[model samples]
Target: MRRRAGVGAIQKHRLEQEKYKEKGTEIQENQFQQMSKQLEVFRENLEDFASKHKSEIRAENALNHMVREGLAWVDSQEPKETLYWFPSMFAECVSA
Candidate 1:
């Protein structure tokens, strides 16, 4: 019957719509999980960077303090006469 054909078409259209909706939801969930994992990795990397820099800053501070104490001419006008004027000397100090 023509009426049964129309009803069958409508049912098929509704099922197709439902299938597309479910597929869209699944894709969105997959994308959300991927983003969450990326965010976690980014946070971990940021924390590692912060931790390394914190220790490095502390070490540099201690080295600078030592250098300032060892060479009294660092703050003087004739600082060039001291090792403070040389970039190589500071590099050596930090490396040591």
Candidate 2:
């Protein structure tokens, strides 16, 4: 009789553990779905913004690229009075 009772208790514990594991898996799936939805919304907003400001974005990227290249060129040159011209050069680069 004691052995039978022990077996019953072990079975009950196993069933409870299985239930908790299933619940945890469900919660994880729900959270993953929510995150995926949020990411989709974010991507849509980014696409909208890009479409609205395509020209401005392209110009800004071009200016940034030019500035980086100019700065790199300046860095490769030896220090001299011409180095002081970088500020004006960068300002003109951005304006253009």
TM-score for each candidate, following the candidate numbering:
0.52, 0.65
Worst 10 residues of 2 by lDDT: 76-85
Q: Which candidate is the best by TM-score?
A: 2
Model 1, span 1-96: residue lDDT tens? 344558888999999999999999999999999999999999999999989799888866766876777642244666565334445558788999
Assess the local accuracy of residue 88 in candidate 2 as a C-alpha lDDT between 0 and 100.
Answer: 63
Which runs of model 2 end up more than 4 angstroms from their true locations? 1-5, 71-96
Q: Each model's number of backbone clashes?
A: 0, 0
**Candidate 2 pairs with clashing backbones:** none
**lDDT at 32 for candidate 2?**
100
Name the regions of candidate 1 deviating beyond 4 angstroms. 1-5, 55-96
lDDT, candidate 1, residue 73? 26
Candidate 2 residue-wise lDDT, 23-79, digit = tens: 999999999999999999999999999999999999767656766776423343766
lDDT against the true structure, per candidate, is 0.78, 0.78
- Candidate number with greatest lDDT: 2
